[model samples]
Target: MMKWACHRPLALVLGMAGLAFGAPGAEATESGASLYLLGSGGPGTAVMPPLEGLYFDKMVWVYDGSAEANRRIPVNGNITLGLDTTIVADFTTLLAVPSTNFLGGTLAVGVTMPLGAPIIDAEGLLTGPAGGTTLTGSLHDSALTTGDPVVLTQLGWQADKLHIQLSTMTNVPIGHYRESGLANLSLHRWAVDGSLALSWHDPESGWDISAKAGYTANGDNRDSGYDSGDEIHIEGAIEKALSPKFSLGIQGYYQKQVSDDRGMLGPFRGEVVAVGATAATTVMMAGVPATFRGRIMEEIDTTNRLEGTSFWLDFTVPIHMNMPAG
Candidate 1:
């Protein structure tokens, strides 16, 4: 028997969602897209799987957002006003956990590949050479393409009812991108993020609390001559197990840029706050245990970015498990 059967189902969902990135217009960074998805690390952030195995996770995300006419957004070496955008992306991730331990903790490695369709409708403006003349027009573009892949590594430690994890993720810019397209699915820049997560779970009381904080350092987009600044993100969740197989929770996140973007007309920092509800459950598929989770979030406040709502659906299953020899 696997050790996860005796533990809470939350352990099965850990580290999977946090590896997903790249949804344009859903959050904010350079060109109205970021390498770190805002609501990706909501619940079960610090827990590690009890059994060594290979796991597969699939996530479906949708977002619809818009910026007011008063704000300006830099995109494709041009500026846009009153940006309205919709994004739909799917992420497939694979996680591998070995039977070995490193530095007194469990080590895990994973990768996420994302495909996205982004639509943008906005008022466009282009300036001539040496700021000589200006052109204004309406722009609408849409594309279905692959986004950047993210690779991650994490170390997890457990102490009684508390769990902690340290993780690093890197974005590889081999996805589909066009320098002059408004509906590009990739950021076309290299970026790295480091995060720390903590979780307190009381099995007897069926209560779980988790929080994660991360920092992202972005590289310049050579195609657009844009240097995106660093960013900070914080996410938290609180949940109660209704039964051994089901749980419900509330989750929220805050994201803000810590520095200014270069090659833009003026200040181009972005910030947003969002809150939502999440639910998860465990089920059996083909005699193997599987987990399903869902979340919906609405942005309550935003600055220099789009304000919108997002929906997420995730499914995870262990493809192979290494049972301990008795």
Candidate 2:
């Protein structure tokens, strides 16, 4: 018989994973539709001493194929010959600041390098002239590139229910734009995202509730004929612990368009509904504590303009600061 060690499920760990794969739709533009905050401020709310730490997050995205259409011309232009695959790498460094009174807040900023490639490798699809033959492979090939920087200011409030946090972030357009590849689809822009969440301690209740909302406003992507300026997103989640070291969480989100540059496109109204689940556990390496997490999400395409449906899978691992002295 094999012996198994039991571990207690932490609501904070499961909530953080829920936010990871919540929705890739147009949220508060932290990093092209993804949230910026890395981990939860559950127990790690204290202002740490100035020291260097390495934090990394990788997102592997594989998009389903769809047909490209022109609204005005009323024609199915071409099949999206390749998938839109994105791999983002973020390297984070934490800096400690002075704590005000009993509440502690930290200013941690990081830079992200987004790399992607269109699965279409064939060339010479759309070369020239009106209609340009194949609009699928006309543009340049997708490759690695640096895309905008994200700065995070997290405010941790020592509350009664749970440690509360208010994080503000910004996104700058410093990337390229390709017609058919991983290039950015929007122009230079900036946004602010805010979230309010709590981790409960009631073992009998066995459930946690968290709600977060975000807003975004910026320039337009005229070259691609898609206007993206004003947007709003609101989300709510319910999480429950199934057992020690394992749990399940569900989340739903809504996006509303505030304004429209519309550029040269058709109906600009867009909204998305997302449902997600997550699982987490602890993995000890060399006597050090590290948390491993996984999430699966499905998004409904309420708006007919964009892709009808999409799915995502993400993993997060949190590194404990208490390492053995060398």
Stretches of model 2 off by over 4 angstroms after superposition: 1-111, 118-142, 176-188, 194-206, 221-227, 308-326
- Give lDDT tens digits, candidate 1, residues 20-137: 2112222245665666777777666787777788878888888887776655667767766667788887888788887537788888888888787888887755655532167688
Across 74-137, the per-residue lDDT of candidate 2 in tens digits comes to 1111222222223333222222223333344333334434443322222223322343453544
Count of backbone clashes for each model?
0, 0
Supply candidate 2's per-residue lDDT for 120. 26
Question: What is the alpha-carbon RMSD of candidate 2 to the true structure?
Answer: 8.2
Quote the lDDT for 73 in model 1.
67
Determine which window of 10 residues in candidate 2 has minimal summed lDDT: 1-10
Over all chains combined, what TM-score does candidate 2 have? Answer: 0.61
Q: Supply the global lDDT for candidate 1.
A: 0.72
TM-score of each: 0.90, 0.61
